[model samples]
Target chain A: MIKVRKLVKRFGLKTVLRGMDFSVESGEFVALIGPNGAGKTTFLRILASLARPSMGLVSVAGYQLPRQAADVRRRLGVVSHQPLLYVDLTAAENMTFYGRMYNLPNLNDRIDEVIELVGLTNRRNDLVRTYSRGMQQRLAIGRAVLHNPDVILFDEPYTGLDQDASAMLDEVLRTVAARGRTVVMTSHDLARTEDLATRFDVLSRGKIAASATHKDFGSGNLLSFYKGVLEEGRQN
Target chain B: MKKIIEDRSPLSLRERAEGEGKTPSGNYLRAIGAVAWKDLAAELRSKELLSAMLVFALLVIFIFNFALELDVKTRDSVTSGVLWVTFVFAGTLGLNRSMAIEKDRGCLDGLLLAPVDRSAIYFGKAISNLAFMLIVEIIVLPVYSLLYNTNLFQPGLLLIILLGSIGYTAVGTLLSAMSVQTRTRDVMLPILLFPIILPVVIAAIRASGAYLQNMPFDQILPWLNLLIVYDVIFIAVAFMVFDYVVEE
Candidate 1:
């Protein structure tokens, strides 16, 4: 569903993604794990067509990067550290606005479905500014999936959620995965992602140093595996 | 020969519909309308931006009253300049704050992700910004007329106002998108905007001044033409380049 070859992203004198090659098949839930400044979010932004790569051959759902960006955008959804929502608009209004942008058919029905899926049915009419951070994040999720995108990218979506909100988000993510869509999520919370993601990739120094499926670590410890990979990267 | 071939090319209705979702042009127009409606609706609910612009405009007029000492004869020469100056300053305030709100709220990124043509976003924002400025101008005109006892309601003056605003906002919207992304955004907008928009303001003041002073058609025609030319040139330039300005 997604492909990247020798992906290199540079900002002025600094380089963030360095010669990275990655691919994901349809319905694969990938947990892109990395420390700060390790280029996880940068990679996701490139996939979402929000940033152009300095050099790479990248494609999402068969559309080329930067050239077919509008086509790619129509097939993908993105949730960054910021919710990317208007705070003053109500939840339903936000969904309706995005609905129009995607030119969806029967938009009112889709808005209702996504709002209920996020469990914001009762609060849908309230202004987003009046909601808590968790509620806003939920609405962001609903907005992302409103048009039924083929791929969804989540960048640290649980950054500022409480315990209950985190649990709620987990259920929502599980539901999304069950629908068999391509999902790439970047997170610092390894424990939760370990249970959710089918594959785990450790990004270090702008490259994927280690990657393993859940079955590869069967009866083994993911924390120790991650630590060993980082230590190995440090030595090399 | 090329024109004949182009005209002879087949345009199957079903293929066009499939290529660009159902009713492509209609959907494009709807997207533009949706964006404008969202901005206007948010402004209506908050009233923060409009109120600030209105109060600042009235305050500027009051200061001008004290600073210029507009006794009957002097008022005739200076009222158009004062009103145009007031609109320019107040219009910048509105433009800067409007773009800043979108940036701070992450709405700009949200809009960028939309599948529609980027120019639709530009037109939507320009239209909304123009609406806000017009609302302020509409209210301020009568108030200024009453205070200075100058008939500011001339039909030609109104046309000039509309034309000048189109030129101001066409450029202002593009510049505001650039300025809001900079480090010193608050100070950046006026600095970037005023220099570029000087032609629009000058033509507007001159044409408006001529209209108010009951000048001959020959005297008024050039400034009016200048305003139209400025509006057309900038609107076309801004529309063509807006995609690059909003790129991350």
Candidate 2:
């Protein structure tokens, strides 16, 4: 489980994650939804141990970070706005490289599996530079899961993807959740995330103003619920 | 290429490993080796970075040939000095391109996402940068020898190459990482890198020059010692500062 208590992060005078608290049990799929500049990325960066929290106790996978981040990074897989694949290498070579980075056994076989899983098997031999944005996005997904990380973080992975690509991504997320891996994704598209995430945490003004499970979300009305949350924040 | 934005995910390693029964630290070296191997293999196929560096080194040498117009009698003493100048400039080209490839293709993010020590990434990149510099030096050596009609094969000169390249890339890797993120990107690499790496390059060239002149061990020893010290200091600084460069 990942536990974050009293988390606070600041940039100069601007506070990003302000006295935030959150936790995720194993296999939970939590979508962190917020507007731009809402500190969603800051919260996630802190959780990923990429940035240090100004004040907080974050215990992830039994590693105390930023103290034991090396340990934490090994089990954590993250896909941010960047596709993060080497353009000079083919998709196969890229995945193979990442697989080796994680020291996964049967690296070649594992690379093949991720390539197929992301449906990039045909393009596997092509240099990633030749890939369309959608193709590169798929390969990015493949790279993230090459090691079968227990915690998967996706920061707006759906941006720039077309409908077909979005559907493919939806399937990928479902497949990952089906494997019981913990997922924390931040997205602006609440409706698209509705069927994918098990829970939604609304980040507003540097804190989680509200949170809900899919069960409590009610009647498949994600837009209304999301709008309501935003309106509630505005009123106060 | 778009810059890599920070992604934060809340997941703990122990929980991930509890199911897989693998320790995170156990895989660190494998991660570094994998990154290094990937770069080496890619370079072997394309030969782009190495070739560019080699050509650039030769161009600088030829430029030096006309620019200096030194008598053949004085060539031996200046051989190491001239070669290092070529190497440092060529080294920056390789480093910039090396890092620019990662930024453009989004490979740096992929590497960062992998469950490996960030230091592994630093070392992997430094080693690859060093390798490219070495390969260029190796190819350039014979050509340099042929052109200058000077014996460039002294074992001491080879050692100098090793140490100089290490010091060069130690700081080169870190600075390149930062430069690649800026709007100016590839162009900014040398601008930022050269100032910081000045000490290393100076010490390297001095030591390399002394070694080539067949100076007594005592005369060459101080510069050699300086090279070693600079290499160690930069390596540590690079390792510590890499996190900041890569941070989203």
DockQ of each: 0.29, 0.33
List TM-scores for all candidates, in order.
0.94, 0.87
Supply the DockQ value of model 2: 0.33
**Model 1: fraction of the reference interface contacts it also forms:** 0.42
- Give the per-residue lDDT digits (tens) of candidate 1, residues B82-153: 999999999999999999998998788889888888888998999999999999999999989888888888
Tens-digit per-residue lDDT, A122-159, candidate 2: 88999887998888888888877776677889999998
Which has the greatest lDDT? 1
Output the lDDT of residue A64, model 1: 96
Q: Is the docking of candidate 1 incorrect, acceptable, medium or high quality?
A: acceptable
lDDT of 2 at A160: 92
Please, what is the whole-model Cα lDDT of each candidate in the order they appear?
0.86, 0.81
| Most TM-score-accurate candidate | 1
